[model samples]
Target: MMAGQEKGDLSLVALTKSFATFTAVHPLDLTIPQGSFFALLGPSGCGKTTTLRMIAGLEEPSGGRIHIGDTDITETRAYQRNVNTVFQSYALFPHMSVMDNVMFGLRRRGDKNAKAKAGEILELVQLGQVADKKPTQLSGGMQQRVALARALVNRPDVLLLDEPLGALDLKLRRQMQMELKRIQQEVGLTFIHVTHDQEEAMTMADSIAVMNAGRIEQLGDPATLYEQPRSTFVANFLGQSNLVRAQVNPGGTDRIVTVRVHDTDLEVSREHLPYGVDDVWLGVRPEKLRLGEAGGPNQLRGIVRDVSFSGVATQYAVEMPWGQELIVVQQNDGSARAVLGETVSVSWAAHHGFALDASQDAAAGAELVEDHG
Candidate 1:
């Protein structure tokens, strides 16, 4: 256990970091509630890691304050702050046993019952049976648990996970995602995770901040950010979105706004899109689209350009007349399917469609995704 059992919300006020001429993290204001799983998600060079490092005291902010509840710790050294980071490398001592590795910090501080304290945390991480094992003797997943055990033993006010699962395989990364969430809930400690993987953040975080060019593009619960993206970058970055240039039509009833995409007219919820703008980007997620008849509230005709199967889902690339390829994903549940080189009609409900400012680049985050891969 840690020396101080203090607990409070972590707050960042106008947090900014710059490297001479380059500003890595623009003025950022964020608050992570106590005991919440929050993720800072973005592609490479987006400043998520810089913000995390500043909070961990590994990097000094050029401006602003960091607080745990009401206590300011902006000038605190890395070791002095009640914060711990679980890095991708694990960083376990190879010569020591698992118990010693976990208890090293406590023993160095002269905690008399360090062994028992470490044992309890090891068991909490389901590593009690392997306490005597060396770091070299453990599997990758087991080694990760030992690293987690070492962090949890200290019971820091906030746990920073800097792409801790980046070194694990896809299957094991997913397994650890759940395990990390389970551990956070069981221990009731605030967790700040920084990663470029959208799916990883969605699966593990209670809320996410999508960063782009050192600024937050969007911040909300995973479902809200995915279903009701407010910007072109967010609409494309969170997941695949089919965006088409559109002009807002004059006729709209109460809550619906009409927009004309090419020759087709579609309606979007006013809550999701603004009405005064003449030009907008109509957006819809791939999974929400259905291959159906031409007549519908929001429908478009396109030719199937490509098809791919990945066990649980089938993805189709539908090419529009204006040289844009829109993606559609369908579940493999015995439903009728579309084939390549076939003309098809795609339709979705009015609520499923969203609108983004036409001024923003439609392909804002596409290249970044490819670059990361």
Candidate 2:
């Protein structure tokens, strides 16, 4: 299945799922570019896991269709589809050695070369030295490697992962994130990873689908998704954002729009906004916002109500004139963070704020359906 295959190519059309009175995922339509590291990111109960399961053929969709490259596998059973998954559980056999666990899938296919292939995959995941170790003997990270080897051993056209790093500790999770990326690049396989960690998704995925209630809120590169979310839900979900409800100022340049928030008018750049018309949410990430100097084109006066030192950076909750608490992040450059109860000016470049439309909001809410259901 190697030569002439479109690596990692997948297409989902109007995919949806419902369980009796509850809807797990809303109808979704997306085309994942071949061989791209795509992330489905959302909180718990978000349909990310369900979506991955649907792709893996573990759960049938309530509606819509699925296609893998040129093959239409909508009705195909899980085993018949050319896809494999590394679940969050690792799901390795505790009684079997690493090599045996990896070889399990191949053995079921009656491949006499299963041992050779399993050894090669174990080496690829840097677990060759522990090929004979049982699951209980290996560390969490090592066990994860075995799980990945098990998935990759089949050489599937696409690999799906569901929070594969969720079980590891913080440091180990970070380490594994890099290792997973390296392996994905090495294999040049299309990897669809489901994760709730925004930083993890941003670090690993070439593009991400930020889901809400079984629907896609935004799909774009990490920079695009973070810098220019298309709806209020997306603005608030991906990271810490100050959502200032505003309207586009009429008679401004296409790239510049004025919005009214809290009895004050704010002029923001529209270049980053995804909507055509501007009844929009001013989406600004905490880091994109700056404090201190005032009297800028896009600026706001606010009182710092609270502050917390988080080692690497300082977090401030600023009460803006609009009565909304805006979060501001200041890098810890060896200086003390801003103090609470201080009056400060918070501002960002117009380009940093984005406009969103209603459909985007609905899509964002849909990304969380599974978590809630």
Candidate 3:
């Protein structure tokens, strides 16, 4: 541990936040394991930021408790909490040098080894060589790293990052994502990152909690959540998914359900069904689908509407007889490309389809238009 820091898990019980008649966060329970990198991911107005702020003690909850290990800190002030936040704004003292900015927090806490500790953190973030340079002299990525070093130098039990890479360009954001993950692992502190970018959360976090409409929609590791989404919202939000309405075959075995989609039978694993229902939404990722002759158990014939070649892969939008489009992605391995207006067969493995309750909204994952007025 660095200086005054201690390793502790963070937990929230029935936490809620409201402003007048609007509730920003509903009462929910969450526990972040010690030294684990967790992410709160969602779109705007989803209460992810509010949840993070409540844990940081920057936003007081309307009800419930916040705890670090066994100690209740719900009533603790922002500065009194054993947590530090790194926001999108680097918030570095522009006039001060990188070294001075990193040491400022330590010196204020009356640590005698402030300079030594700052130097150590600077090296950890790979910014020791530019310690003498001011924030203006550094690149955006470098400034963000300096801000990270400053926060980590305090050695807070938990580090909160509020879209720290939002201001960076695409390439730089990808670079910083790996860098942040590396730094978090090296320091062994719990990191709670909040972001609207799905790729960013999936790339860096050990576990992710998908939030929406002031509640958690789903929570799991990256691969599990991506491969086996529990809801249509999660399936569409995390990545591209083709959801087709299907009905469970009447005499199917419990281990596998034969779903009828567009006059074709598709075998889906019964284990993927969350509830016992005859009506279901068969979900499959675009990459899981293949374009070929109709010889598989799950196969559909459609007219190719469009083709997009994106270097690594080719995406095809095939329009079915019912006017629904099925998106398929094929790796660019020198295979013959499908031509638009040509009829083709699309097939996927039986187990690749995930069944969700049909009662759920078919447009659950559609993007909401934000009111800017």
Per-candidate TM-score against the hidden true structure: 0.95, 0.89, 0.94
Residue range 181-262, candidate 3, lDDT tens digits: 9988888899999988888899999999999889899999999899889998888778878999998887678687788987
Which of the two candidates, 2 or 3, achieves a greater TM-score against the reference? Answer: 3
Clashes of 3: 0
Clashes of 2: 16
| 1-373 per-residue lDDT for model 2 (tens digits) | 3222344469999999999988889998999987889999988777999999999999999999988877777888887777899989999998899889999989987889999999999989888999888999999899898999999888888899989998998999989999999999998888999998888999999999998767787899998887777666766667666666676666778678778766678777757655566566666778777777532567888899988888888888999876788888888876434677888888777777766653444234324333321
lDDT of each: 0.88, 0.81, 0.87
Positional deviation of residue 316's Cα in model 3 after best superposition, in angstroms:
0.4
- Clash count in backbone of candidate 1: 0
- Candidate 3 C-alpha RMSD relative to the actual structure: 2.8
Q: After superposition, how far is residue 219 of candidate 1 from its true place, in Å?
A: 0.6
By lDDT, the candidates rank as 1, 3, 2
